[model samples]
Target: MAEILTLTALGDNYIYLIVGAGDAVVVDPGDAGPVLLALKGNGLRLVAALVTHHHGDHTAGLAQLKAATGCRIYGPDSRCISPLDHLVRDGDLIDLPVGFVRVIATPGHTRTSVCYFLPQTEGGPPSQPAANARCTRPCPADVRPTTGPALFTGDTLFTAGCGRLFECDAAAMHRSLAKIAALPDETLIYPGHDYAVEDYMFTLSIDPHNQAAQQALRHLRDAQAQGRPIVPTPLAMEKRTNLFLRTDDPPLAAALGIRTDDPATVLAAVRRRKDAFQPS
Candidate 1:
């Protein structure tokens, strides 16, 4: 089983270090300094680095980490980002020390954006569904254990929100989100940025009376006040509160004054509204 270590880098970006099995893998190393320190602190050897997209914030540390640790870099085939050691696409499985990662293409924020899905493996702390029903499992004192399958969503999907469309259209983004929504509800989501508080606040603006969204926003506010991370949210909770995931709901159409039947149309309208929406 792989133990995931969350390291905050570049202000809001999160870099994950997966240790266990026999080797270690780092995902989206935005800075070489923090990643190197974390590896040394844990006495772990870096064997590989997984990249979810070509975004500089996600790949800026790739070259440095690769040089220092000789870790192989894996990312999309797009030329916009740094050269990758291994070009990955949809459905490709990459092996690591603890567990293997299944590559899922989720292009919307960028044409080459992708997400890494790690299946649940035995080894970490016992599953604590109640505690982690809304946020990522807290790191244990010792080496963390595998809780279950975790999704490393790089700017494609955030808690209660989604990424800006820089490369694809609303229809494409809707399709990509549908793929993630189809995953088992228990799947844990590790977003690239710590945007839960802001995103949840935005949700409240659009869905003022939504009990689930309201309660979730309150819980997130408390977590923030306590300096607790609001990420690694459960997919189940996201399904309940994420406005982007509810493009098909009739209420969304009514609220946005859009057609109800076509998911893509509703999604497009919502995205446009969000782009211009100023959170009060």
Candidate 2:
């Protein structure tokens, strides 16, 4: 099993290191300083780096890290970004020392945004390519596992919120979120930023009656007070607390005073509300 480490950079951004067999793969490295220090401290070799989007905070460290380690850089097919050794697309898999990192296209935060899904292997390869797995409308039943699948959602999905629709419309973001919701309930969510407290607060603003969100907020507060990192949230916990993932929930729609049952429409309304929201 690969060991995952979270490094904070640029104040709020998170850089993840997946270490196994003395080899490490970093995801969305915003700063090379912290990553390099971590690699040296752990005495691990940098094999590859995965990018989820072309944002500066995510890719700024790519060129430097690659220059230092000579590691392969994998990311979306976009011209805005540079130093990409491999340009991947939806359903594409990049083999790493830890395991296979399946690329799932999630364009909303940006036109080229993507998420990386790493499924756990018990001493062997997966039963089949995860790209071949069929996904249904709301959720997928085929991807569920007991434990050890991690989704690197960079600016796409947060603890209780989703990314702003920078280059795409609300419909596009909603579709991308639906794909993430299809992952296994036990799948751990390693988002690009540390926005748990603010996000959960926003979730409560939209879903005031959600006891799960209330409880989660309290837990997050306690974790923060204890100086613990609040991340790698389980998909099951997000399903219960994240408003973006609960667009189809009738109560949430009612709370928003939206009459439509269409998730996309509901999501648009919620996103607008969130855009205008001011935290107290």
Candidate 3:
């Protein structure tokens, strides 16, 4: 049984706890206030913390969580802003009792930004026997453990939007997003915000004729009305609707008047346009 608990933090950020099979691990606790509430509320014992980047909104409460729960933290060595218990890099897999999560170095959202991909507990080479399965005495196919992966995309990808290129150039941001866009369609895309609906409107303004944005807006509206999560977008879904992920398309280039087909060039134009978009 794999469970990911999400805690709302600092307005839009999401602090995630990937739990199951008797162990629990947290991914980016922006503050201890909400995390403590989540732990106590859900009766969960945090085993570790994964920091995707060093920004305070992502790490401000790390020290306190460690003080309170004594959870080990995994992050980049360059600067997690919080003190690191385990410094990891690209291609390294950290072993937990239940399974393993690989670190994919995805810089651009920040110089140290990295994404964690958690492998499912079943059907890979040799399935890890579920000490106890949750769905049934014998887990069924539909309820069988997911065999793909789950991604915790911090500030890099939002619901229908991407993070602002604060420190990294548009080119680097585009490259980083491309890496994320290549993941399997089934991979869950948990992001750091609940800011999808509004951002989708802004994005729509840039491409008023875009149908996918309209569909995403409708989806976001319904999810918001029902108080649901608007993220964990599939890779194929992102390729379909996310303007930032489609920076090289001709319509996008035409929108920005850029002639180059290079991904970076297209990113420059898109960012330039969004950076100038002001609500009327």
Candidate 4:
């Protein structure tokens, strides 16, 4: 499997480096400085860049990086950005040094928003015995395995929150989120920003009794205190703790005092509450 490196940029934005065979593909490079430094430090060549949207924060560094490395830029079909070499659509696959990345159209954060999914493949023989073996044991709760499929959601999904509705309505965002929710439980979600603390706090306000959210908030606080990255959240964990993903749950709707059972309505209500919520 290709190695994934998370680089912090523009404060909360996350720039990912998908590296393999001495080549790297950058995802959402908000700033070119860190990416360029990383490439030189690691002696890696920039092969390509993947853009999820046309937001300046996500695409500002594209021109600079391309000028430096002459890399190909792949993104949603848009005329605004000038460096785009390939226009990707839903279900389109792009070959990379790591493997093939499948594009998932998620249009809510932006009309051109799209996510890249990298399916996990077995990397040779397992270093340890199978589950049936006598010496097999479960991994610790704090230790999450990184060798799994990954979803690069640029601003569309956060650790415990979804992006604000900018160019799309709540219903459109709901549909976009549903597509992401349908991925495998083990798919690792790499979102664009670091909003764990505020997002989880908001979640607690809505579902105060949610033990999962409570535990997650504590974990996030600890991770933040230690200057750790609270990301690459698993899809299974999000389904359990993310209020946005749980809009369809009856209990979540009741928490919002919403009488309707329609998920989109509940999501709209919850989203409104979140927008006005002041995190304590």
Candidate 5:
């Protein structure tokens, strides 16, 4: 029984709540108000907080959350918030009942950017095609593994689009992304923002005829129409479609004038295009 909850925050930001084994951890509390409210709604306790970076959008709620939940805070010392309970770095492993949660020190998006790779069973991809006759197209079984991890990518990888490279160069960001992209394709992703609307738009811009992205958009449309958020994107889907993660794709790299193996160059070109792109 693995449960990952998402709390809406300022604008596009999200506060993640994960019940890990015996403890509960919240990753990247963008703001306190919603977190507090969400905790109340879930009837779950918050044991600690994992901050991926030091941006205020990610840490602004720390002080208030601490006051409210009394949870210990852990983050990169580089982006230290006062009263830092614990500090972890690259190659650090945190024990949780779900399994040994490995801390992947992924920098570039930020100097201290980190992603939690929890190697537990992914419940399943949201049953996209079902009784709905119009949506009954089956997803590839080998492509989307229903059981695996949850990548808490804070402001780094979105549902479709990647994050804006603010602190690191495009090269570094691309490298960090490549590392995650190399993970098992079925690993589910829990990004720090809800950018599905705009992400699908960009997907259309770069790969206008991308069948996968278009299918996802349709699934999302059905979900939203039913008043639900389309999230927990499968890593397989990201690999197949996200330009940032798919820079390794032969056709995608060719489009960017880069070798599929050259993550840095492909990333730089993608970053430039993303900068100039306006979702149509």
Candidate 6:
């Protein structure tokens, strides 16, 4: 499995470095200074860059990094970003030095938005144990596949919030989110920004009685207080705690005045409310 490192850039934006076998690939490098430092410190070769969209905050460092490291740039075809070495669409598979990533076109925040899915490197069917060995022993955290297949949601899915619809309509965004929702429960999600606390606070206001939301909010708040990074949320946990993902739930629908069971409608309503939301 590749070791993932987070480089905080452009304030809240996150830049990810996937390192394995002395080779590395950067995801959405909003800035180059931190990435250069990380590469120098780790002594890893920058092989390629994976871009999710054309947003400047996500691709501003592309030119500089490519110049310094001679890394290949991969992204959706767009005029906003220049000198693309490869144009990827949905279901495209990108082979890297470590593991491969499958492209998922998730166009909600922008028309060209895409997501990258990398399956966890370990934890398939358990091996047969000895006749006298216990079959129910829990796996050690160190041995477990914590770096399992992860999704790089550019500006589409935040921790508890979804991105603003800049180039697509609500229906399109809903379909895009649905694609993400179909992934395995264990798929870890690494969004583009560190908006977990703010998104959680907004969720608490709407669903104050939601235990999962309350717990997640408290956990994020504590993490923030401790200066820990808040990201890579599990898909199963997000399915339960994220209000944006729960728009189709009957209780949430009712709370949001969405009488119809249509998921797009409910999601649109919730999104509008979020757009106008002000955290207390």
Clashing pairs in 3: 189-232
For all the candidates, what are their Cα RMSDs to the real structure? 3.8, 8.6, 5.7, 6.1, 6.2, 6.7
Better of 2 and 6 by TM-score: 6
The global C-alpha lDDT for each of the candidates, from Candidate 1 onward, is 0.80, 0.83, 0.72, 0.83, 0.73, 0.81
Q: Look at candidate 3 and tell me the lDDT of residue 198.
A: 68
Write one digit per residue (lDDT tens) for candidate 3, span 102-153. Answer: 8887777787788888866443311332322333332111122334567888
Give the per-residue lDDT digits (tens) of candidate 1, residues 190-276.
Answer: 888987777777777778888888887788788668665565777888998888899889988888877568888888887787788
Per-prediction TM-score to the true structure, in the order listed: 0.90, 0.90, 0.85, 0.91, 0.85, 0.90
Clashing pairs in 6: 118-149, 119-149, 120-148, 120-149
- TM-score quality measure for candidate 4: 0.91
**Model 6 over residues 86-173: C-alpha lDDT tens digits?**
9999999999996888999998899989999887757532222122132123211011123467889989999988999899988888
Worst 10 residues of 2 by lDDT: 137-146
TM-score of model 2 vs. true structure: 0.90
Q: Candidate 3 — which residues are off by over 4 angstroms?
A: 78-80, 121-148
**lDDT tens digits, residues 214-267, model 4?**
988897787778655677778888998888899889988888887888988988
- Consecutive 10-residue window with the lowest summed lDDT within model 4: 134-143
Question: Where does model 4 exceed 4 Å of error?
Answer: 123-145
Which residue segments of model 1 deviate by more than 4 Å?
Answer: 121-144
Q: Could you tell me which residue pairs clash in candidate 1?
A: 124-145, 124-146
